[model samples]
Target: MQLENKVAVVTGASSGMGHAIVELFAREGAKVVAVARRKERLEELVASLADAPGEVAAYPGDVSSREVNEGMIDFAQKTFGGFDVLVNNAGIMDDMSPVGDATDEKYEQVMAVNVYGPLAAMRAAVNAFKASGTKGSIVNVASVGGMRSCAGAVYCASKAALISLTKNTAYMYMADGIRTNCIAPGGI
Candidate 1:
């Protein structure tokens, strides 16, 4: 019951690390708003957690849109009473294309989901926490690739941008009681 009654929003909640985080949070007594592109997967996730101590609501949407980011925060607050945590875990990888081989579309897509989306979500979270006078946490899931050149150029650049954004958010909002940090995990 460490997070009893806490509310959390997790992106990319259909699979991978995002799914795992949502389950863990629910088990720890945190209500979760699960955001993902696949509606069926989200439903399955919710169904599988029938016995968990906390609750989960599925939100089907792409993480690349600012509107979606804002909507998730709004929905969390409206549905569960508050937004206590946000996990920006939605990200896309490039196709191992080098700079010369990378297309504008690929680079833009990577950046949109990996960098811009998370930034939008974090901004909305901070604003909500500020207005409510509540302390909160934001966790942006970056990659080891961001720190070193281990992936395609576009992916590395997108993740690097996310890392920078996370750091800046921490510095800017720490005084306001919003703690932000980036997790650079190795390949799963």
Candidate 2:
């Protein structure tokens, strides 16, 4: 197993890319703490992974909250021993409105979840690794929209900010045994 004995935290674990990453990580032998907003769905996800090589534990909450972000790390440490990987995969898209047509609420909501959420989670993870002297891996899921301008104003700008954060984290923490990288997937 590529991640035998590793413990991971995956946000947005009830659907889409987050769910997929949790399944893949479990198959590769990394115990996972799945974070999402839907308690029932999160429970279902954990149940479905019952026979995987590793394990899955559900923690339902909104990733945009710093407490929720830090709580995931604490759950990993308390449940699976320690944290080694974090997949910052939770995100929301805007209404595809141009900046001129966008509302302040949409802009704020998208940025809060996309940028600040990941930032808070990664911060907690990095601090955990530093304190425990553990080498860690952080995978920030960005988008091609982040690099270009395909997804309208709020989403595009939020993703762009995510990409920049990923780069900065990589450079800032590489020597500390925490390697950060981003995946800017195109389309599906």
What lDDT score belongs to each candidate, Candidate 1 first?
0.95, 0.94
lDDT tens per residue, model 1, 57-128: 999999899999999999999999998999999999999888999999998899999989998999899999
Clashing pairs in 1: none
Root-mean-square deviation (CA) per prediction: 0.6, 0.7
Each prediction's TM-score versus the true structure: 0.99, 0.98
Please give me the total number of clashing residue pairs in predicted model 1. Answer: 0
Candidate 1 ranges with C-alpha deviation above 4 Å: none
lDDT of 2 by residue, 39-124 (tens): 99999999999999999999999988999999999999999999999999999999999989999999989998999999999999
- Total backbone clashes of candidate 2, pairs 3 or more residues apart or in separate chains: 0
